[model samples]
Target: MRIVLVLEYDGSNYCGWQSQSESCAIQDAVEKALSAIAKEDIRIVTAGRTDAGVHAFYQVVHFDTLTSRPLSAWVRGVNAFLPEDISILWAGEVPDDFHARYSAVERRYLYFLLNQSARPGVHHNKVGWFHVPLELETMQAAGKLLVGEHDFSSFRAAECQAKSPVRTITHLNIVRQGNLVVFDLRANSFLHHMVRNIIGCLVYIGKGKYSADWIDELLQHKNRTFAAPTFSAAGLYLAGVRYDPSWLIPEFSDFPIISNGVLR
Candidate 1:
């Protein structure tokens, strides 16, 4: 049977989502736990792969196992074998035809930028910090230019393996809540480092280094070198992924990470 699981994790501890040969990745930890529970080899597929130091609010993965255990065993039992930084939120059995990555219709990422003079103390790796006071309205204006479908090559990473640089960004909004600058982005999909690269450009604009028109120029150029450097991954999150309701994946918005980052 095919099992789908929603996971929440503090990526601060592991080496991204993909398993490494040394087994230091979040995927390695998860597979290890699943293997212990199923008493068999277990490999899983994810909806998306997050980079090192990136967190996930609702990461979806699926694995096929002949060991027929209850869904609760997948959640509570598997979590027992996993470390404190990772937890399985929900598990459901799905049709064998369902795929975690291919079936995804949209992906959303949230970048939490702590805009303050002093660095974060307790929330060290939990946020990206810009010491300078940023202009919210200016960043908001620049962010709007990036909305809609376009070639996002400028915002892609050099090592990105995506076959096409074209992506349709359905939403891009930057809002400030107190001292926190929240960047919310939704796209059919994103190239590697796309959100972080775009965040860096928006931060440059927010700090008076560039104007809103710079985004348009970058988009027209379709060159990665023309854009700002990729921002820190510490603040990035694979916040959510959407699939067809017919798949019957359970909702997990009740998790605080889904509502907002550490600070809410």
Candidate 2:
């Protein structure tokens, strides 16, 4: 049977989603719990791999197993052995051909920035902070330029191994609520550090360090050197993944609720 799982985790404690030899990765923790339950080693694949300090509200993964267990076992059973910071939200059987990563049509990410002079206290390490006041109107204008298919080399990390710099941003929006600024981005796929890099540039634009048109110029340049530095990984969240209807994955619409009871 092929099992699919929706996971929610506070990535602040782990070394990212992929299992590493160091045994500190989220995948290692999850696989350990699963293996203990199945009494067999289990390998899993995820929809997307988030970097260190990044959180995930709905990360999807699938694994094949010959052992037969109730669906609830995959949820309640596996979660029993996992740490409090990681959780298995939903679990179900998927078709043999369904792949968590390849089958995903679009992925969504949300970035939260505390845009006040005062440093975040309770929310520290959970959100990005910018001391200077931000100009939301200018940032919104700059963000609009990133929507659509484009070669996003400027926003990609130097270590990114993707074959191409081209990716399509189907949706991009920037909005401000009180002292919090939210960046909601949806794309077919993302390069390493892509969202953070873009957010750094947006921050610069918001602070009047760059003009609104600077994003367009950066996109046209296609040079990583010309873009703003990568923003903090603390602010990024793997919001959700969208797959074809045939996959029958559960639909989740609510944004992640963090410790402060703020919805991102």
Candidate 3:
């Protein structure tokens, strides 16, 4: 019984949340919808790993079952056998040292940027990287010089395997709306693609083309070619995963799948 899942997908049809070897992933479509609702075989474990086309609104996973269903049969039996861009926005029973990726302490990400100049007829594939005319207060003052603790080897990912590129960045906002420019990171951990190479150098420092002192000389030169091009994962999102309140559970944030994706 370990259970804990919250998922929401549509990374434009898979190949992201881990488990790959040639595409088609979302952990192999939520482990084949939790192995057809616990008929057996299940293997889930996440709280991170979102690459190919990246997207999630509150991804978290965990597994271990012996049947006994109910939690609304693991959320209406894994959203009735998953598919239409994945669903299953809830499930419970956690705390055996709860860990949807090492008892995650913090991890949030938002990275969107739709500058405007037309081209988002209908939320254009969930927003991000539309370019032209960005200067939301100098991209929010270079995202407040990348808030807090750092070592982010120039925004990581050059085959990042993360054994330490150091990290802390508690938050880094950069907001805007008409033509959207979002950004919203938060961290305690992150390496691979590190928020799309720190929004490709915060969109080259919000389009004056780099210089918040080139992010303190690329974090004092840890290097990744001083970063500036890993932006569009179609507006990345995984937006949540902070655990520690005795690994919460009772009315876990008033449940509704813990406000699943914060109201879309």
Candidate 4:
């Protein structure tokens, strides 16, 4: 049987989602736990790979195993052996055709920024800190220009391995609550460091250092150097992934609420 799992993790101490040769990774930790339960080697595939210091609220993965364990065992049993920072939120049997990565229809990401003069105290590795007041309206207006399908070469990382930079941004929202600014973005897929790079440019526009039109110019130019530098990965979160309803995967409802107000 194939089992699908919803995972939540703090990426502060891990190398990233993918397993690495020399460093600890979230995938390695989870697979190790699951393998212990199954009493055999178990491999898994994730919906999206988050960078180092990037967190995930609802990461999805699937593994094929012959071990006939109950859903509770897969959840609680596996988590018992996992590290404190990684967890298994939900687990269920999925069809053979259900893929954790290829079956995902959309992926959502959220970037949290502490925009205040003082540095963050409690949210040190949980949020990106900007020691300047940000104009919420300006950031929202600039984000709108990035909606729809376009060549996002300017926002892509130089080490990006995506075959193409043209991805559709179905939704882009900016919200602010006190000194916390939230950037919510949804797309079919994203290139490497795409969200962080976009947030860097948005921060520049929010600070009034660049006009909203600068976003459009950067998009048109299709040059990575024309855009702002990539922001910190601490603020980035893999919010969720959408799959076809026919797959009958369990639903996740743990997305953070924008408490203040929606800017756009």
Tens digits of per-residue lDDT, candidate 3, 3-25, equal 88777786966767788876488
If both were scored by lDDT, which would come out higher, candidate 1 or candidate 4? 1
In angstroms, the error of model 4 at 96 is: 0.9
- Model 3 TM-score? 0.37
Residue pairs in candidate 4 whose N, alpha carbon or C atoms collide under 3 angstroms: none
Clashes in each model (backbone N, CA, C under 3 Å)? 0, 0, 0, 0
TM-score of 4: 0.96
Report the error of model 1 at residue 49, Å: 0.3
lDDT tens digits, residue span 66-183, model 1: 9999989999999999999999999999999999999999998899999999999888898999999999999988988888988999999999999999999898888888889999
What TM-score, computed on C-alpha atoms, does each candidate reach?
0.97, 0.96, 0.37, 0.96
lDDT of 1 at 245: 84
**Worst lDDT 10-window in candidate 4:** 255-264
Candidate achieving the largest TM-score:
1
Question: Model 4 off-target regions past 4 Å?
Answer: 254-264
Task: Compose the digit string of candidate 2's lDDT tens values, residues 9-36.
Answer: 9999988888888998999999999999
Lowest lDDT 10-residue stretch of candidate 2: 253-262
lDDT per model vs. reference = 0.91, 0.91, 0.76, 0.90
